[model samples]
Target: MLVQVNFLGEASGCYSGGMQSQSSQSNKARRRKEGLPAITPEAICDAAISLTKEKGLEGWSMRDLAAELDAYVRVIYYHVGDRDAVTSLVIERVLSEVAIPSAASGWRAWFDDLLRGLRDVMRRYPGVAKRFALVGPGGHAARAIAETGISLLREAGFGELSVPAFSLLLEQTCQFVAQEDDRDALPSLRKSAASEYAACAGVPGGMGDLSKSVAHATTSESSLRRYYDDSFDFFLRTVLDGLEVRLSNMRG
Candidate 1:
């Protein structure tokens, strides 16, 4: 004899219990879709990305996205499932726009070019970068980076050992780029934070002080550009040094 557990007033048998909820959800989705305005997943993702850019990831919500796109919140759910799925789709779309370096440039040059492109893209879309960190790597962008890393490692003569390490390195580089990009956007973030903090602190126009602080902290764009160039060069050199050591040992 088997005991049946009641879940949400549904009889829980061996097979019917688990699928009952899923079936109900499917029916609900169908009912909701009847005569609803059609919104594509891509449109939802794009709208979400846009909202993120104007208002940081922390500031974004499904309702905000819906307002930006001039669509119903339910349409977003119908098209993209939920917030997590929408974020994933947004990252995928942005990364897909990145141009992968040609193989003819040789592995080292190719990897450098690829990473630079990634850094540029992340900088251009600071909101996407923030979301990317929380979501971790997924979708076509990750696949493209992995495939390119593997090919580069093979060209550099690392055999199978370099594949996983190279992938990890690429992820680290992305994370670093995201951080650096956020740093550049700190002034705006600080202003936003200050305004919120001021409202909570019962201080009128507290955002002004915060804006000044941000201005003091953020360096000139030219200086930041120089820093970016120096940092990337240092990172590439360090990676190449490690690769060279491994190659030397292998040759030995």
Candidate 2:
């Protein structure tokens, strides 16, 4: 089960800073006169998420977030501390949307559902998938997913290897999604790579069966989205099959 985050709603409770400074008071007064709603930490995070959706997580800055909210840059700091803090919130918010599968679905099926959903969600917010691949999922939103995944692995006889198995599954999946995001950002590079591979395949006696293996992938008839989807599906199935073999060996 996952905890749902409020993306657009105001958070409850007073600001934890104890009391507002004179400048903070003046800022609030100006906002009142200008008919702007009071800013909250949640609101600041919401704006950051929107900016990330448009310009990617790495492409936007605190200045851009401030401009989006029509507030001073310090206002973003006063509410959410800094860009890092806001980034954490944005990641949490994005991850909260990941669909968790039922334990009754069995271990392999459960992970298949979870990873597919995760790929779709993470792909919507560029660079966030790479962060997950590098640092792992660090926020509250990812806790339930980890817990359930490990429990299923243990039940499936991973023994002391449960943690490592889960880590490998997630890390590899996120890396694939991150690579897709990067490849998508550079269409020309992808086209160039395809062309070069096609040329390599055309060389007489150079590539043998390997060229035949790559011929379908190099075809320009398929849409880019279709190519990515087909490739991701193949990769997912292969990884799951490999894990199943590993599980068999462990049992033996």
TM for every model, in the order presented, reads 0.67, 0.85
lDDT of 2 by residue, 2-112 (tens): 122233332222444534456678889999999998888878878888888887889898889998888888766666665666778888888889989999988999999
Judge candidate 2 against the unseen true structure and give its global Cα lDDT, from 0 to 1. 0.80
Query: Every model's Cα RMSD, please?
Result: 10.7, 5.1
- Candidate 1 per-residue lDDT, tens place, 21-62, comes to 575466557656775334566566667778766765656888
Clashing pairs in 1: none
Sliding window of 10 residues with minimal summed lDDT for model 1: 1-10
- 224: Cα error in model 2, Å: 1.9
Q: Which lDDT values do the candidates have, in the order given?
A: 0.65, 0.80
lDDT of 1: 0.65
Best by lDDT: 2
Q: Which stretches of candidate 1 lie over 4 Å from their true place?
A: 1-38, 130-135, 188-219
